[model samples]
Target: MSRTLFIIDVQNDFTEGGALGVEGGAAVAAGITEYLAEHGEAYDLVVASRDWHHADDDNGGHFATDAAPDFVTTWPKHCMAGTPGAEYHPALDTSRVDVHIRKGQGVPAYSIFEGTDDAGASIGEVLTQHGITDVDVVGIATDYCVRASALDALEHGQHVRVLRDLVAGVAPESSEAALAELGHAGAAIVESGALPTAGAGAPEDGDGEAGTAGDRA
Candidate 1:
């Protein structure tokens, strides 16, 4: 089985100092960096997802704008395309990333798989073309992007695992709910340390840490 790691939305816009920062988002980058440094060579593929949007786009317009009325359900404007906020957090080690998927360019794309290239290839399609079957996911805001990507991977028939320790959330309650939903949808929740060592056997059940983001979910 070809194994792949999908790092989802570990961008500056979602972390501590950005426009729409989530609680614990910075920790996601730190944890993922640690995991990659310790197990960089274990996976055959490494991919990342980034949210790229335009300031005047519909998604961005949903938030308060000097030119538009504020929508109660909308969030703050963030992750403008090509800006520093749209880039992955500086702490995440991107040296091993073989693919980078940019999402939410013109729409409310919550899933990395929803991202398409100029030629219309999806993240899933790219992974399929690359022969990746087993996928592990890590990144920010467990209730949103991370959960959506993991579910989309499972739907694509890939064996999916969520790195419980390497994710954060906009809120604890919603994050917990999302994790339970992912588990019910057949995603394995695992800790970074318990990931299979290269050439070692896969675990019967993906080992997860207590009190982690997914645990609250």
Candidate 2:
């Protein structure tokens, strides 16, 4: 089987010290780096998604401008296009990444596959061209971009797996919901340690129930 690894939004802006930091986000980068160091060669393809937004764009102004109503609670300006915040987290090992897919450049794109080049080919299309079949997803904010990308992968008929240990979330409740949604959508959820080898055929949380972290309010 052709296997691929999709590292989603492990950008500096989402890490612990960045503009819209998620708790434990830096740990996700460390964990994925360790995984890649050991098993990077097992995957046929390795791809990464980045949130590259322009500084003067609507996405940037949404938080600063008073004209628009505050949506999503008006997050701090982050991941602006071509800026350091928009780059991958420093701890990430990009040596294994075969393709770099830049998302959220034009609009507020959460899904990695949502962005398309002038030729109309999506990141998914690019992966398909490279013979990627099974995909393992990891990285920041499990409740948002990671979840959206995994769902999109499933919708495109690719077998998907979420590296549970290699992801952190902005909100505990939303993390639980994303996990449940991923399981419902037929995604296998496993820890990063089991990736690319031991847990390939393991059954997911087949109970089809959402689970919340105990500390979540």
Candidate 3:
């Protein structure tokens, strides 16, 4: 019944003031910090991920190289390694993180499974080594990295949950769609306040239906 927390891409580049800032990104960061402060000990491990792209290369076409950029496939240069954008948000308490993973080094990567730990271990390897059977994911851009990470966790045979209140997204419609997809893929969707004590009360099954937030669009 080991539970692990996956804090995905809470770096400066994805926060409210960064290169790819989301609307509620700053609030999500602060909310996660508050959640951790109250329930830090609930999980066996806390892993934080960052988009540590290279400055020279296009990172497997993840970054736009042409004059016109497609927001879907190509993004403005961001999270370059060793740059301020690659650093974790100042509001994030890194001291609580047990492992640090760097992704999209020189390629396109979204899921935490695509990254390696500080010790050069894959996310799957680390989880297996830790006997992590349950996972809770929270971070920036719910429609992308967070969604990818949660699906990968489920694929790895772990019971997965996404804390809705602790995440922000790039767009309301896409974010709600992503949540529906994750739910359909067997990941539980729950609010942070509704999460039960780890191993004591398990997450309820998701209905695989899209949330109401997308209606604003």
TM-scores for every predicted model: 0.87, 0.85, 0.92
Q: Cα lDDT of all candidates, in order?
A: 0.79, 0.77, 0.85
Worst 10 residues of 1 by lDDT: 208-217
Report the lDDT tens digits of candidate 1 across residue range 1-217. Answer: 8889989898998998898787777777877888887777778888888888877756745555555444234667788897899988988888878888888876777889988755668887888798988888888778888888999999899988887878887788788878888887888877777776665667754454333355322
Q: Please identify model 2 stretches exceeding 4 Å from their true place.
A: 60-64, 67-74, 116-120, 196-217
Estimate, for each residue in 95-205, the C-alpha lDDT of model 2 and write its tens digit.
Answer: 888888877664677888877644657877887797877888888778888989999999988888777878888888788888888877888776655444434453443
Which stretches of candidate 3 lie above 4 Å from their native place? 196-217
TM-score of 1: 0.87
* Strongest candidate by TM-score: 3
User: Which has the better lDDT: candidate 2, or candidate 3?
Assistant: 3
Candidate 1 wrongly placed segments (more than 4 Å): 60-73, 117-120, 205-217
Q: Pick the candidate with the highest lDDT.
A: 3
After superposing all C-alphas onto the true structure, candidate 2 shows an RMSD in angstroms of 3.6
